[model samples]
Target: MTRLLIGALTAACLVPAGAAAAPAAADLEITIRNVLPGQGELRIALFDTANGFPDEPASTQPTLRQRADGETVRVRFPGLPQGRWAVMVLQDLNGNGRIDSNLLGMPREPYGASNNRLPALSPPRFEEALVTLGPQGAQIQIDLKQP
Candidate 1:
């Protein structure tokens, strides 16, 4: 038992102090882009899952709100827990309903996800959009494309 305790203590000492401690909150910088016509009031949310993957739980909710710029936007979110994260953004053009899309199913309006989620032939998956926020909140770029 004494030997086991000494071994455990030695192992613990080998670990980095910061790594053992809780990660510091990070300053997150979010970039929302690609706004179509008629797409107005926009909102963004940052979520986290234990691992970067297809299905994960929201670790945090950082609301990003702004007007339609019809271009890429840079929004700064300061002081966020460090972990694997994802983003959710919507272009609420009319106060009435959700973001409007065209007949082709392409976004007639603006809406986006994080990790620079670019939809291919299919929609962007959660794994493709997972971001890592370390000790210091990270600066990430996200480009939203509608399909």
Candidate 2:
């Protein structure tokens, strides 16, 4: 019995501490600014991977739609798993639920990406707009652009 007790105690001591603790979820807050005065909806997308980033359809990823109240809009995403993420915003002036493009296939309305990144020739890549979220969470700001 004494030998059995010693062996059990030894095994217990070998186990690492805090192994059962799970990581906490993170909070992410995004603020979109410079939105043109209009009566429409603001479409926001949060992407965790580059597979289907800013241009992905609504069915494929997480998205939020909010009314365009003024020049600025704020959104909060809480309890998100800790990791890297990117953001995209579209100001749907016509409330068409989609971005309108001109003959050249260029966006006709204002849009924005995380980090305020605007590409001159092509769409912004995930790497250019990545944001890291930790236990402390993160807060970001994006400014709308028109072309």
Best by lDDT: 2
The residue pairs found clashing in candidate 1 are: 26-137, 27-137, 40-93, 48-59, 101-108
Give per-residue CA lDDT, model 1, range 91-122, as digits (tens).
77675445565676555545567766656444
Question: How well is each residue in 41-127 modelled by candidate 2, as lDDT tens digits?
Answer: 889988888877777744756688988888888999888888888999999999887778888778888888999878876678889
Q: What is the lDDT of residue 59 in candidate 1?
A: 44
Note the Cα lDDT for every prediction shown. Answer: 0.66, 0.86
State residue 90's C-alpha deviation in candidate 2, in Å: 0.6
Model 2, runs deviating above 4 Å: 1-19, 57-60
What TM-score does candidate 1 reach?
0.64
lDDT of 2 at 126: 88
Weakest 10 consecutive residues of candidate 2 by summed lDDT: 53-62
